[model samples]
Target: MALNRYYYPTKYESRAKVISLGVKCVFISHQQNDKDAARKIADYLINAGVDVYFDEYDGDLRISHQSNNARAVTDSIRKGINNSSHMLVLVSPNTLRSTWVPFEIGYGYDKTDLSVLCLKGIPKGSLPEYIRTANIIRDIYDFNIKISNVLEKSQSLLEETKLMSSYANSANPLSNVMDAMINDPYN
Candidate 1:
């Protein structure tokens, strides 16, 4: 919640224009298996004019991971975190088995405004110890509220996007993953 927001006057300003540093850029961290779901979240944010650093579109990160080049991949993740003002850790069943997700969380914990976005069916009790302590976005509505707070947007604006209706009655972006989740979030 304590994200460092710095705004500096542009040196080459056409009249003392102020520029914000990574104002609403969000770094999305999710397991490889959850790429599709992550993309949906990213798309939703993008539609709302938020900058997102989803690894799915990072060619360098993809090549590094495919080559098993841990150093390169780590560098890419670090760079992504450095450029983002916020971090959204997408939590699902697959997240429990991920090696990189934990690292991302740890690295970005102090660097960005971090929040754990749990998929539907993931109980508060089932969250990992590290994640259990952070701000949690339980469902799509909660996500909308928390993100809108960060963006300083009105609920009316979100409703104007026509996405809220799609997410009504469990039609959320990660509805498939949410539906596939078992009663037990750990396993």
Candidate 2:
């Protein structure tokens, strides 16, 4: 999957600073019928220090014939997906009947580096066709672990990059001093 090639510094310019800031956001996709489950997941993530972009909380619900509200909602969803580091789809039996869920998944896969399928109240053998190909977390424990791992990995990579940069900048001077004698063989 394309997620295998996911890189942090390429996405954010100030890699070390970004990691140190400790702010990770996730856009959640789910059917309106599954709002209760979705809300629970959002709350859990929030308590775990993740910023959640949930449509019911962050989207417009008012409908107007004069205004293009549908388009507005789509734009909001797209922006949310684009801004977030990860997109998590809450998969339930109701998800199979949702038209928007598929669109959200497709957009997330195309636009974001990480798109996770979180199965809720469903059997593993009965997963939908679209969900069958995603990075899936079967339970809340796995979901928590997955998010924690992603954050930890990103922070670790940032620390490694910072160390490498520091070494590259400082080691040249010492190397040059050592090589001074070699360059001036007569000394």
**Number of the predicted model whose lDDT against the real structure is largest:** 1
Candidate 1 ranges with C-alpha deviation above 4 Å: 1-22, 161-187
Please give the RMSD to the true structure for each candidate, in Å. 7.0, 18.7
Q: Each model's TM-score?
A: 0.79, 0.63
lDDT of 1 by residue, 38-133 (tens): 878777776656667788767788899999999999988887777677899999889999999999999989878899887756765778888876
Residue pairs in clash, model 2: none
The reply for model 2, stretches above 4 Å from the true place, is 1-23, 59-68, 115-120, 153-187
- Candidate lDDT scores, in order, read 0.71, 0.55
lDDT of 2 by residue, 41-94 (tens): 665555445666676644243232126676776665666665566778877678
